[model samples]
Target: MSPVLLFAVSLDRAHLQLLRQRYYYATWKADGTRYMMLITREGCYLIDRKFTFRRVQLRFPRRGVQQGCFESHHLTLLDGEMIIDTVPETGEQKRRYLVYDLMMVNHQPKIKLPFHERWKLIDKEIIEPRTYDIKTNKYYRYDMEPFRVRKKDFWMLSAVGKVLNDFIPKLSHQADGLIFQGWDDPYIPHTHDGLLKWKYAHMNSVDFLFEIGEGNRQTMYLIDKGRNRKLEGAHVTFPDDQDPSNLSGKVIECSWNPKEQCWEFMRVRTDKPTPNGWHTYMKVMRSIEDNITQDIVLDEIAEIIRLPMYAERIKLETQALQHAARRR
Candidate 1:
């Protein structure tokens, strides 16, 4: 079924009543607070007051609001994303969410509304004017293309990637993927057209403990384990040459292990010198990983082992050497 049709039919009478009873229009709320009302086959619904662009945390209150709306109004089908935020951040860029269109309201299909009107309601009823310094008085129109009715194509993949790349950096929080909706399509729940979300798999690098093997092994670094070993206090090394002076401090991204729950060493960054401290290393690693794009891949050997491995390996090798020395 069409997305709009699905959303409209899903709502039962009880669900609609809850939305109208609980939710106050966005304009009615205090500054810095926002509300979202979504309509689906189940009914009209409100998102948690805590929900925002930074975090989408929907909860029970929102469900109650939805039930209230369905019971009170004729609103039928309406399904779309909502966001509210106050004291937005600023610097390189400011962030804000744009509502594109409406599919249903009060059990009535509203996609037939001119695209312009749908946008107008979102601006007027939902987003507060001063919340993000958005000039709603200006013209905003829905310009995106609709989803494909047939088989997926190459263009679809490219579009998904492009959307993710464009927004992920600007968002204050983590962005996993992009959501696609047909420009002409109406909102639908549990259906193909009204919405499709695409998530991308990302790669990152970080420093981990490395330990090196000893005895009969000329050079093998491995994870550090507590032991009175021959090689103690040895600095971790990247396969590529880096300034030794900078080597003793800081961890760098090497690779991510989904199962191991640790990051492998990549290269000691000579350019970005870091100070010594586990907290500092963690902060740097997280920031760097967050900035990493899909283009970066972990392929180097040294990057595979973490920094801790180096310390553990050194301890083991040190003990092995001490044992050999005693034998002599």
Candidate 2:
């Protein structure tokens, strides 16, 4: 089935050069906030971490002063990812939404617009406008942080350096991965056309339904998407604060270690009841195995910059954007 929203494709040099995109922010693992909001929306829908939507109706406050007024605005409270950010120094956790995109606006779907235009729309229409009415603000409101982008200053970043140097120190949330998007192209729903997402090759992780092994070593497995095959293997690493022995028959995360030639342990995935199906497991494995590394990525950029032949399709478009931005 087609996904209900836009999704990112795994990072690749060809796609990056095609889009002429170099800047990216850390992908905050807001799995705890497994929630998606459809704003200025009359109907209801619940969005999961996977960006799947389930329609639901939620009650809202009725207008008192306006005669025969019907409430069209509904703040559909989704029960998906609940963000829990832990403070490293104070050991306190806070919830936040570092919005990556603006998919919709006041009854206007911005998915078809180019990203640079869509980003400007988001800033002007959503973030800049604020309501002072405390009572009304709570209901017809949203909690989100501004999503920013860098220009030439960030063009030389590596996927590895992006996560470690840019994301790790500045963020309290899980710096799970990196996402590259096209600024000159329209949003392609449920596909990786103009978008590319990736995690650290070594830390490319996946969750599985864990079981105890013969020697008390833990193993995990995935039920294939079609319910046909069971894909199982390897002892996984337990979380920093959990008892590994207690995790038998539960969900846990495992990372692919290319150097050690094994699947190493990462953490216990607590967000969902079960591990991802076989299809997803294979998808993640493929991403890790077929990863386009930081060095190759940077090399691609350097090639495009040095030689005109490397990025002919979108080089002019990118240059135009920079030129316009400078003039403004």
Candidate 3:
């Protein structure tokens, strides 16, 4: 069976109020291909959004007395994205899988657990053990592994500046926006309102299926599974190095240019099988017109936090964290 995936909704004015209602952990949204890693006795595999699985030539240590140095006896499922990063010292590019959430660990389902608890389990069980092995040279065939596994870091909403100014600059891969995940949210399979993705107004983009017409003219279509709706004002010109014919039937991202009054080609979305639907396209366009800045979002959050009504909620959240920490 395939693991159901959760999708993040676009951040808007309505989402701003959610910050006051509950605590959220924020991280940079990586511009990479999303995948679910399943570790079983048979083998370790990467499952894509399209429900395609690719077995990896790797193994996980049994961690305890077994110490079998093989894939775990219990099934483990993880959510993450695959990214290509540049190694600073060697200036060489390498593929890395950045895991963000845990679904099942040791065959025990964690989908019902709070996001904070699930993340903690992923760190203690999956990330730490592997890291310790690598550092101590325990020899789990590290040299034979195709890619490195990493835990994506999350921070409090107050640390948004640190993420944008400090963490992003140090990253070797591309990050498009900020992701806000509810601290107490359970793992909802699809379109979780508590999970939000926010990009800079100018950085907002939409994916469309590109088609070439007569006279080398081009048109863009939104592939919404049920229908291929043509998008107006989506005129595009490919880069000099890219061939239009080669890009036919491919999904391409485009950002609206206010001054130019047209959509500008951002890049080809090779990872996505289809373009976004009508709802997503309109939301992105509205976000662009609203032009909400990071400063504005921060200000809204600060204002909400100062209210007396949210005081008790903040206190309870703090206490919950403190209690969880003590238990750990």
Residues 55-171, model 2: lDDT tens digits: 544332233213334444334221123445688899887754334455665455677777667756544543333222213455443333222111111122223345446655676
Q: lDDT tens string, model 3, 1-328?
A: 4459998877877777787788777899888999999998888999986688899976565565235353453589999999999989998999999999989987889999999899988777887667667666664568779998988888766567778878988999888889999988999997687898898766788899998878878888985657999987668766688788777889988877788778777888876778888878877776777777888877776676566655566677678989999999
Question: How much lDDT does each candidate structure score?
Answer: 0.32, 0.53, 0.81
Sliding window of 10 residues with minimal summed lDDT for model 3: 64-73
Better of 2 and 3 by TM-score: 3
- lDDT (tens digit, per residue) of candidate 1 on 230-259: 223333334455443343334343544445
Put the candidates in lDDT order, highest first: 3, 2, 1
Query: In model 2, where do residues sit more than 4 Å from their true spots?
Result: 1-3, 12-34, 40-46, 50-92, 131-168, 191-194, 213-219, 239-241, 277-280, 305-328
lDDT for model 2: 0.53
Stretches off by above 4 angstroms in model 1 are 1-78, 81-101, 105-108, 111-163, 202-328
What are the TM-scores, per candidate, against the unseen true structure? Answer: 0.28, 0.62, 0.87
Q: What is the lDDT of residue 233 in candidate 3?
A: 61
By TM-score, highest first, what's the ranking?
3, 2, 1
Instruction: Give the Å error, residue 236, model 2.
Output: 2.1
Per-model root-mean-square deviation over C-alphas:
25.6, 7.2, 3.3
